[model samples]
Target: MGKITGFLDYPRLGETSEAPAQRRKHWREFIRHLGDADASTQAARCMDCGIPFCHNGCPVNNLIPDFNELVHQQDWRRALEVLHSTNNFPEFTGRICPAPCESACTLNINSEAVGIKSIEHKIIDKGWEEGWVTAQPAARPSGKSVAVVGSGPAGLAAAQQLARAGHAVTVFEKSDRIGGLLRYGIPDFKLDKMLIDRRVEQLRGEGVQFRTGVFVGDAGAGSAYDKVETIAPEQLKQDFDAVVIAGGAETPRDLPVPGRELNGVHFAMDFLPQQNKVVAGDRLDRQILATAKNVVVIGGGDTGSDCVGTSNRHGAASVTQFELLPQPPLQENKPLVWPYWPIRLRTSSSHEEGCQRDWAVATKCFNDDGAGNVCSLTAVRLEWKDGRMAEIAGSEFEVPAGLVLLAMGFVSPLQHVLDAFGVEKDARGNARAGTDDYRTSVDRVFAAGDMRRGQSLVVWAIREGRQCARAVDEYLMGGSLLPR
Candidate 1:
């Protein structure tokens, strides 16, 4: 809307990353943000489309056209305000989101979509550089208390919103630090840990209390990432007026095949968090290292791609990724799937670095070396017909795999946590709660994020958290002024 003819004059310009050879040497963010002029030009490409489907495309419903116009006008202050109005953490989404908003752009029908994500990235980065980001503390206290369980995007979002609304908010994290998946599940190469630390500082300034290494459940010992300081589930109910369960889906889907007990096979969650800890200057007695070993990452998803990138950084001899489903088309059929998420092949930066990617391949079993160490993987090709999958005859093969990382994705939240709260569960085993109210069967308990919706993107988690906060506020008070 800033420039009527800008779309015709400018082509989409994306952020550039350092060469794989150079970037893999360190665990830092390598993607460079666009310059001011370039970012303005990209923002100017936003058309005055009668309806902005991109707003709906974004899970958080970001005001895309408004921010684009502000960036094009070089009003960085206003741009940041507009971004923060909807998203609590644009820096996170701008860096990692799949950008469904661009896929739903009207210009995408016949031309390249406007670089909305890049513009967002530029705005947020500029905000931090100009010292525009600061803590927003409430002027008055509401005299109510809320306990937010877990500190992922959802929990963090809800805590910030609730705190701003003048309620006393305390976030409990099972891990040693805040940010559940963002802190541990994601690889450091894509997202630096300092970003999370920056936000944590701001959140503390906003009057949100963070209780780390405090497991609020059936009070038990913690895992390798966090040592346990137990808090009974009933204690939270007695202390806080309301409790929001934002603990994400952590029950990983397992591949129970032969040699699963081998020494080298591990869940992606177990493998990824260790590397993050090491990067943060923590020493581990027994760390899973991919160095000089043939690594096989099973499952074609973001987690699997992360495994490939981390393995490459570890100087693995080779990295191979396996996908159970058939490959999708390189390009989407926009005519048929316009204004919605499309089925298309996505090549992550990790895949481009160096990886052998195969689709429609299913692992049958893990083969072990003589000492009960995983040495190879047996797999078979599959054929899909009429929505049914069948293995092809004579397609069995084995590949060298000194280390195997299972990244098939999470199945549900840990049942013990749900049982501790005594909350009802959905058919998928997610915490039973509706988005309309986010209220669980228990009167004062609520659920959001992956705990309520199952596995999803970071953006969706943030959206759920924000909405859940509003629901809690409305229930606590008569109504809330917070945006939905």
Candidate 2:
């Protein structure tokens, strides 16, 4: 409401980015946040709608209009405060989140929605540059302790909140590094790792302890990392008053077709982590490189698009992405789905880097090159009727590929970890925990993020983590001042 008619005067302005050809040469963030002037103009477009559906649209229920008005009024410091009040890591979400809030904007019914995400990106970055972002240690200690398993967004968010609530928080991570998925699963081109490092330091200043290379489960539970010290679930339950299992879903959905055992076929997780490790200056004896190879990434999602960008940077001969489902409409029926997330075709920056994308095609089998390596794949076109898919008659085709990366998304959390904790699981194998209490069946155990809700967005992970922290705090102190 900073400018009553600003929505009619201004159009949506997205952030600028480096050209694909130039950006593909290196592994670094290429997209630049909006400048102060552009951000203010964009924020001005926030219409004084009676109800802010963007609040419900955002997983953290970010005060979008409040920050937008602050930015429009050129109050950068206040805007950052409003942003950090809800989102623990706006920088991460600003970079990777899909911005469901924008889709739910009141002005989005017909005109373009305001650039809320970009404004958030600007506000946080400016806060850091101005030294406005700092540690907020608790004034008094609650004397309670918490053990958080997994150091991803959810676990980190929970640790930060509990620590600020005057509880001693220790975060356990299987990897040698602090960030779990953020440190490995995502490419540096999309999000710079230094951002995570700064936040880690901030949390450390707030009295949160990070125990890397420590698996909080059985040693034989098949942790991806080696040389990690295993701590039994019972030990954590005894050492700490409460435990929060915020470990993310890591079980990748596999394509169990013929020749799945081929050498060139790998899960996106395995391939992606190696590249990130290499980028972090860790040399690997054997790395999966898409260099000069015809790479076929199965699954048309953000992960697949990431593969495309990474492959392009690796100088792949070609990159092709496949989707089993039919393509969505470029533009959604906004009137029908206004104030809600609409299913529309989304083209990520990576997709624009150069990728041949196909939809409604299912891989039949991987063709072998006679050396236990994948050479090509047989696929069939499919048609959907009444929510059922049927293969088109005699439409099988073969595409040459030296590498295949499965990016079909994760199914659930590692069952062994949950089993070690002896927590009950839901039908989908996620830890059975209600949002209100976030308590697992086991005493003093809680679950949040993907561990409880199955695989989801980063923003949802943060929301669950914050709420889970409040639940744990209340369980311990019999009352909590922390927000849900």
Q: Report the number of the highest-lDDT candidate.
A: 2
The reply for model 1, stretches above 4 Å from the true place, is 219-227
TM-score of each: 0.98, 0.99
For model 2, what is the alpha-carbon lDDT of residue 483? Answer: 88
Local distance difference test, candidate 2: 0.94
Model 1 pairs whose backbones collide: none
Could you give me the TM-score of model 2 versus the true structure? 0.99
Model 1 TM-score is: 0.98
lDDT of 1 at 14: 94
Q: Least accurate stretch of 10 residues (summed lDDT) in model 1?
A: 218-227
Clashing residue pairs, candidate 2? none
Q: 1-484 in candidate 2: lDDT tens per residue?
A: 8799999998889899999999999999999998889999999999999999999999999999999999999999998989999999999999999999999999999999988888888999999999998999999999999999999999999999999999999999999898888888999999899999999999999999999889877757355653578899999999999999999899999999999999999999999989999999998999999999999999998888989999999999999999999999999999999888998899999899999999999999999999899999999999997889999999999999999999999999988899999999999999999999999999999999999999999999999999999999999999999988
Candidate 1 Cα deviation (angstroms), residue 40? 0.2
lDDT digits (tens) for residues 164-202 of candidate 1: 999999999988989999999899888888888999899
